[model samples]
Target: MPVGLMLVLAVTLVFLDLPLVVIVLFSFNSSSSLSEFEGFSTRWYRQAAENPDILAALGLSLTVAAAATVIAVVLGCLLSYAFVHGRRRVTRPVEAVAMSTLVTPELATAVGLMTLFTTAQLALSTLTLIIGHATFVLVYVTVLVGNRLRTLDPRLEEAAADLGAGRLRTFATVILPQLRSAIAGAAALSFVLSFGDFVTSVFLSGTEIAPLPVRIYGMLRFGLSPEINAIGTAMIVLTVLLGVTGLWLQRSRRSTTTSNPL
Candidate 1:
């Protein structure tokens, strides 16, 4: 039964990931249209490089993702700390409310955010999209940081305090270092979510603030452009590289801790 289930899972992965494989392969096709699988060529890649609009949209996406990740990390860490500490009574409800957004339909969140921003007279721009993305990413960050905090031994902080370290110093020197994996994981997830976001970006982006996802959607709507496949390939490569780096960092941390038991 277990082997059968594993086979099923493997089949599912292959089926789901087939589009990405096609995108990567089509990215190198000599043909301009993705429908025609011509001989291998890097023409689409070169075209993507020359397209200034694509470059601008990519830059905007990275900027919004970075900004949203920073905001999510800061707010998430604080909320995780508060909830992990004795202030659970106050923070638990807030945490629940924040998490509810994660399970809610994304379109619903986008509509609600748009309405709130409209009523508040907040202009729709990269900043507004960052706020919208942050709202969703915060839930992920909270889960990451909170799980790490739960695994941690509070006595370590107590020991630091006993050694005359102030609360801020203890947190900086002890807590943050231990939660490094969680922080990195959270930030990476938040950045990826914000970068590839479509629904929220569509609602929040102004005339001049179109991000990569929006650009890709427009290209897709026009038809399957090989340039879009090239972009998709690049995004897949980036995500894989970042995921591998995070895994290495996590393993390195675990190795160091195992080798040096204090």
Candidate 2:
């Protein structure tokens, strides 16, 4: 926490982010040369805008991410709730199993999922992509929900019950509201992970259902393109904006809760 060490850490962080900065800068370059630094222009952006394939991939990625996030939110919430409220012996093992997904390598998981789908004669379509994305996203959702539930006061639910509210009503009116931030954060993280996912998507996505990350990977095989840089730069900006908004909302909620303590 010393000032000099903090400065060094800040500089190191900036160095780590330099690649992204380079991508954003190269995105606006007009020159066809991918190797050399070029002056700023929106030519690559224009090309990206006109490329129907890129647009289609982006649309597909969004759709898959949205669908997967929705599934994860519901399933994660249910799993977390059961684990948190159920008998200790049962819930402990169940929670551990649910979180074990995070311990496995993503490549191994994708390969396993692909093998299973192939064995079942399932088509590698958008549906498969959503399923693949959801598989990993579910763990994130569970982690978020479980962490929030751990911090929540069980007395709130007890109080609601003491007032004659049924378990369902107490959960809907009391528990769910307190979990809003975690839910939103988890959903956002899932969406980003799904959207940015390349390896799983590449294996599960069919010829017709290519997502943006897969498309970007394909483009890379042909060598780096300025348009790819442009697309990546835009994605980086959008991601940063979303992250800032989520953090701001989290802080604002905490401040409100503290100021209006009951």
Residue-wise C-alpha lDDT for candidate 2, range 112-175, written one tens digit per residue: 9999999999989988999999997999999888887887878888899899999789878999
Error of 1 at 242 (Å): 1.5
**Once model 1 is optimally superposed onto the true structure by TM-score, how far is the C-alpha of residue 90 displaced, in angstroms?**
1.8
- lDDT by residue for model 1 (91-115), tens: 7797788778778999999999999
TM of each candidate vs. truth: 0.92, 0.94
Model 1 stretches with alpha carbons more than 4 Å out: 1-3
Best by TM-score: 2
Model 2, CA-based lDDT: 0.88
lDDT score, candidate 2, position 44: 94
